[model samples]
Target: MAAGHYGLSNLIAIVDHNGLQIDGTNEEVMDLHPLDAKWSSFGWHVLMVDGHDHEALLDAYQEAEKQDRPVVLIANTVKGKGVSYMENQVEWHGKAPSDAELVQALKELGGDPS
Candidate 1:
């Protein structure tokens, strides 16, 4: 609100919209649906994009640069993306992976486990 009131066109904020928080899913905790509308109501220029797509993210930044007010990029992404076991599992939020889990996760991502 303050940013919009003061017209902070230079400000750019990025939000990782993974739909999960430390406790649980957003819907299970506090529902903040119509997120774009909420931000727009605050007089911000909102850009929605796939969080995993590098090209889409770059494009969003470029678009934000052309806006005349504060801009926010909402990046839609999956929690623990690419790792099957951890993906969207709330327990993974604050827990560190075990040594074996780390190796498996690395393999799943095609990264060298060494």
Candidate 2:
């Protein structure tokens, strides 16, 4: 709101709307649905896109740069992203990956395990 009033064209708020938090899914915990509409209601240029796609993210940033007022990118993504076991699992929220899990996650991410 303050940014909109002050005309801060450079201000961009990128929200990672993963839908999963510490406890569980956002719908199970506290539903913050209609996210884009909420931001739009506050006079922000909202762009909702798949957060996992690098190209989509770049495109969103480029689109936001063209907007006059403050823009908010609602990035819809999975919580644990590249890790197969941890993806969307709330237990992994605050917990660091175990040694074995780390190996698995790294392998899944295609990173050199060495």
Candidate 3:
């Protein structure tokens, strides 16, 4: 709000919109739908992009650089993206994976587990 009020065009805020909090999904906790509208109302230039897509992210940032108001990049992503067992599983939020789980996750991601 202060940023917008002051017209801080240099200010850029990136939100990791993974739909999960420390407790539960954003919907189960507190729904903040129309998030882009909320920021826009505050006099920000809002941009939405796929969090996993590097090219999309670069494009959003490049676009943000042209905005006259504060910019907010809402990056929509999947929690624990590539890990089959951890994806969208809130229990994995604060929990560290075991060595075996790490190996499995690495394998699933096509990385050398050695």
Candidate 4:
């Protein structure tokens, strides 16, 4: 709100809405929380999309750049995204991944072992 009114047209804010905060599920504390609506209500151009999708991310960014006001991209991300056991699991939030899990996660994100 302040940014838009301040004439910061090029400002952009992207938040990873994985519903997993530091302690517990975001829903548990902020039940039925609508990130998009909240930001849009605050006069921000809001975009919602899967954070894991590269194409969607690119498209959203392009669209945001076209907005005259600040844009808040509410990306639906998965905490510990690529790891099987960590995906969408709140326990993984702020927790360090095991060495094995890190290796697997890197591979999943297309990081070559070499």
Instruction: For candidate 2, list the clashing residue pairs, or say none.
Output: none
lDDT of candidate 1 over 1-114, digit per residue (tens): 999999999999888899998878899899989999999999999999999999999999999999999999999998999999999888888899999999999999999999
- Model 1 score (lDDT): 0.94
| Winner on TM-score (1 vs 4) | 1
Which sections of candidate 4 miss by over 4 Å?
107-114
Ten contiguous residues with the weakest lDDT in model 3: 20-29
Please list the residue runs of candidate 1 whose C-alpha ends up more than 4 Å from where it truly belongs after superposition: none
Candidate 2 vs 4: which has more lDDT: 2
RMSD of 4: 2.1
User: lDDT per residue, candidate 3, 50-98, as tens digits?
Assistant: 9999999999999999989999999999989999999989888889999
lDDT by candidate, in order shown:
0.94, 0.89, 0.94, 0.81
Q: Give the TM-score of each candidate.
A: 0.94, 0.93, 0.93, 0.83
Residue 63, model 4: lDDT of 94
* Residue 55, model 1: Cα distance from true site in angstroms: 0.9
Per-residue lDDT of model 4, residues 8-66, tens digit only: 66988989878877668877767647677877777788888898899999999899899
Q: Whose TM-score is greatest here?
A: 1
Kindly indicate the candidate among 2 and 4 with the higher TM-score: 2
Which whole-number lDDT from 0 to 100 does residue 26 have in model 2?
87
Model 1, residue 100: C-alpha shift (Å) = 1.0
Looking at model 1, residue 17 earns an lDDT score of 93
Ranking by TM-score: 1, 3, 2, 4
Poorly placed runs, candidate 3 (over 4 Å): none
